[model samples]
Target chain A: MNSSGVRSVARIVARDDGRGGTALPVLESDGPLALRRTRGSGAEARVMLVGAMSGPLGGDHFTVRARVEEGARLSVGSAAATIALPGQAKGEARYDVRLDVADHAELHWTPEQLISAKGSDLHVTTRVDLAPASRLLLREEQVLGRAGEEPGRLTSRLTVRVAERVVLDQELACGPGAPGGWDGPAVLAGHRTVGQLVVVRPEFGADPVTARVLGEGASVVPLAGPAALVTAVAPDALRLRRLLDEALTSLL
Target chain B: MSRAALLVLADGRFPAGGHAHSGGAEAAVKAGRISGAASLADFCRGRLHTAGLVAAGLAAAAALGTDPVALDRAADARTPSPALRLAARKLGRQLLRAARATWPSAELDALGREFPKGAHQPVVLGLAARAAGLGPVDAAYCAAYENVSGPATATVRLLSLDPFDATAVLARLAPEVDRVVDRAVEAARQAVDGGVDALPAASAPLLEIGAEAHAAWPVRLFAS
Candidate 1:
């Protein structure tokens, strides 16, 4: 038997509806969930993940789907980093996030970091489908382990499709024995936390508004255009968090 | 050592692993964005304008006997993506190895020892051209051709495009390639005539993003 707990929350902010911006109550669902919204105004709404329980204290799986209809402008962000505590049995968390932007619609999905405690495993997949004239700014941040703790073994995949065409496909697998793995100079560069941000705006010109967030111990690179990809890494989780926040602020 | 010798050095099949790299073409092809010969031609043309043009200009400057170390640094600054930089060095090392074997000039040998991690491909290609007794224009043209064709050919292989069609694409792009090379050669000549400090900086952002994304993939067919 599959005894699982599920929580679903959706919020929509319509700019011209003229309520000075009203917030929706957080909705909860005990099973698989979906949220869809259509708005006429250029408003933004964020969903915070708080008090959601899963399988064991550590091992778990969750599916999340969100869509923004045509002519709607939506922005989504998480309250804080979602933690996957070390599992008794190797555990995994899967997120299949899909965003659909219609003609001239704009969507920005910038979620908080994903922190995997030592010995935990996780996989997160995000698929963005954009129309011909649609625009999207999507960002994801992942930190392997807590400071002073062994970095968790994890695999993360991000696949982006535009106009029904696959544009960006990325997969990262990091552990102790993998060849040229996380510790290699090519990736992570021995850093514990890494963040990636992608912006796709076909309407924008070659040189869009993209900036790098550089801190004492971390670095952020921003790419601009019809599509842009950024990767940043820091020594620890805290520094990674700070760098990501700064990057999003500048990028958005 | 003549212009023909420089052309030989710039040949796509110089055994420098250039054949194995599509210079981001493989990634673009796998993404299904680049489908046919026409699109491939368009992609190559864009690459020529961006990555190819920049590398060619830099190589031309290096051919003027500019400081290899400074040229290497400038190339690195122009290439913001670690993956692309690493790819350039890998190709550079292979090219350097070939150059050492074919033409063991003291300068080329010295560069190998000095830049063990690999100097940028254009910088090394320029040095090799000079050591081979090729002029600045020849060196610049060779650099442009190699950078453009490396990816064009890679796309052909990755997408299984017809070789005849692919060559036809290359033939169509020949004029544009020549135009870019001519511009690069002129700039290189001006730099040499004036001073090596006139070399332009590298600045192509979209390619850099693709390089970084390609680097992070768990499994990839191309080296970079």
Candidate 2:
């Protein structure tokens, strides 16, 4: 890894102790990234991720691989927001995430916002593989550029599979003049920040209150095979986060 | 292969139920991203390279005799929004009815039987093209052209901006559209051996997001 670049890798796997106690996460990390484990009083364990540096910049690649074993549960979060800064060479920053949930396991990953500064480009690729009976709740939020500045390019590709079958495959490319490009009505309709929430569970029942909370310009679409997707856009990250949290809370 | 079959499939009036949706152009127009012919052309270009390319590739692959069920699942993966999925299936069912009547075949009938509600529109288009004895490239061209043409024609009604200008917008995009079809066909060839994973999955979130938003509009003119 370059001095200015941060190449971090961490994997958290939960294992049942064969007793009534909750399974703990096996944590590992390198570089400027820190992984902190929090004891779960209820039915799941918690893990907090923190970075010594600001965030991944140009030419920086950050990766996280996480899994939840059978009969185990875990929740992952970030210490603070991730700020992507412009690098010296103008290259794009990359975040690659891989997650797997075994049978009868659950994993909820709610990370902080990822803000891309001006002249910065960010690409995130997330692949999730789950067992037929596993459950997952994933939330990702992105804010393009700072206030009063031209937004940077951010492309996100997500693929979700259950029992080796593709459940959802999504690719989002946003920049100048892109569809849902900046200020476009059909896409974001001029919203600077966009957030997404995905939930897949066995008994994920219906909730009419969720749609009412999304209000204008936000939508909650229930996918086939016990999955629900929500996307919202707002003028700022705070507003978008609030809307996303509201919808997610209702679903939860 | 009857060459005229390509034209028949490519005609905008095939009654495939495409006229009801603006291809997300209505939201863009309402947001002021599509004010005139120039902006509309730009939007079409972006869509052509992204969603259009992906749709064309799927259509081409289906035309090459790829598994329709597998392609349908791949289409589901590529499409994240439920509203878009519903629209694609509706159009697929509608296209199946038309294709079965126009060019009766066992394959089309089986597909209809398999997916009574519907499959993705591109997959059905590919199967229809195959039933008509057309090649993957022809199917790709049809899907690619529809990607931009649907929105262009819809904008003509939304903005009432000169119909000539909208047609001209498509005319200028003809070269780019051909390029997209070429890429789609090439990807389809790879998909023949590499499986559905080889097909393009490039997506436009705004389209997915727009599809969802548009679906909620109780007062919208388009079905999607």
Candidate 3:
């Protein structure tokens, strides 16, 4: 057990090959970060992140960066949910994902839920930079603990910028050291799972979305920019995903 | 740095449009999550730390002389609910009007011109505190206290809860508010040196969700 922890960077750069196909110019992986170019169709490129090792244990720093050049369509996903575990190190684990979509490009960042195990502390930051004409569909889900267990400290920050202007920036902290009432009736309301879906389409710039509540635990609303944000919380991941997927259908 | 100025800015009767908003309490009330004074305290405590802390950060940053425009954007970032965003800006606009009349400052005038429709309320509150010759902590204290106090006042009208009990809920949460303010001021100071990224973004999911549901309601006591 290397209590020292690991630092990893897995990256993907997708571009239009100028031959009616998308090309991954760069696919790099280091340490526990593994990247694979799955089968793609037409002008789209897909990447699957395979965790070669179990971690982002405490004191580990992991980064995933994806850039979609103009005219390219990129879809990124993970094989399984990431489980944050406590290590001998003294600090929290860090996982950062940076995404950039150029004009007329598209990106789908549909990562699996991050399960925060007991005694584990992890901070996940996802920053997305998009062009006005760029299309993006990102789904983020957090499952507090495995099941029938209490969650450790987990903080997740999502910041998205469209056309160089911030569209949405928010952070949700749960578990230890978090402010009170997180699990109260007004926040999670005792829900152990929370998730959000961010949809940004060029058409939304002119034809905006009217805010509406989808369910008791979910709502769809517009952001400051040409984007729609859907937030939901449920008793479990299955229900959370079901709500998010329903919202996705309407959004798409 | 006159102590009374903090009172004036944080006053619920300041005509800044805060009274109309329940800080998501209306939705919580309808949800039956808050039935009495004890539940009311629980609700306010949640808000005081999440939204309250974020507001205090923005207010403290603004009072520290950070750009109001940037702070406004930060506020937009921190607020995910569109209804909540609109409410904050509306309150900000009203607060700006009141602050300009109370204490005129070139910074406030510039901010007014920048966000003619209004900025975020906490940003405006911070700038208003600065105009009143107060510091970042004072602004943070005002924002943090107001976050919980507004809902406390609103609950009295919504549930017909004993006015004494409502006041006591706020009184009991004073220490928590102070703790939130300390963290907020610390974040504000960090923001001054490290940028808005350093500001605390602690958020209550239910509050944001409840605000959205509340906005859709046709008949409601609070505007937000």
TM-score of chain B of each: 0.92, 0.98, 0.98
lDDT: worst 10-residue window of model 3 chain B = B9-18
Candidate 2 chain A: worst-modelled 10 consecutive residues by lDDT: A204-213
Candidate 1: where is the Cα deviation over 4 Å?
Answer: A1-246, A249-252, B1-3, B193-197
* Residue B43 of model 1, lDDT score: 64
lDDT of 3 by residue, B1-224 (tens): 79998888877788777888888889999988888998888898888888999999999999999988888888888887989999999999999999999999999999998999989999999999999999999999999988888888999999999999999999998889889889988988888879887898887878888888998888989997
lDDT of 2 by residue, A1-252 (tens): 354565678777787656744465478876756788876757788888887777678878889988888888889999888877777644688989999999988899899988877777788998999898899999988888778777777888888887788877777677763433234434454678888888888665343223332565467766655677777878898898888878877777
Q: Please compute and give the TM-score of the first chain of candidate 1 against the native first chain.
A: 0.73
Which structure among the candidates has the greatest lDDT? 3
Model 2 has an lDDT value of 0.81
Better of 1 and 2 by TM-score: 2
Q: Which DockQ-derived CAPRI band holds candidate 3? A: medium
Residue B141, candidate 1: alpha-carbon lDDT: 81
lDDT of 1 by residue, B129-177 (tens): 8878876777778877776677767777788888888888778878777
Per-candidate DockQ values are 0.03, 0.44, 0.75
RMSD per model, one decimal: 18.6, 3.0, 1.6
Cα displacement (angstroms), candidate 2, residue B5, comes to 2.8
Once superposed on the true structure, which residue ranges of model 3 sit more than 4 Å away at CA? none
Q: Could you tell me the lDDT of residue A250 within candidate 2? A: 74
| C-alpha lDDT of all candidate models, in order | 0.63, 0.81, 0.90
lDDT of 3 by residue, A130-153 (tens): 998999999999999999989989
TM-score of each: 0.49, 0.89, 0.96
Tens digit of lDDT per residue, candidate 2, span B24-43? 89877775678988888878
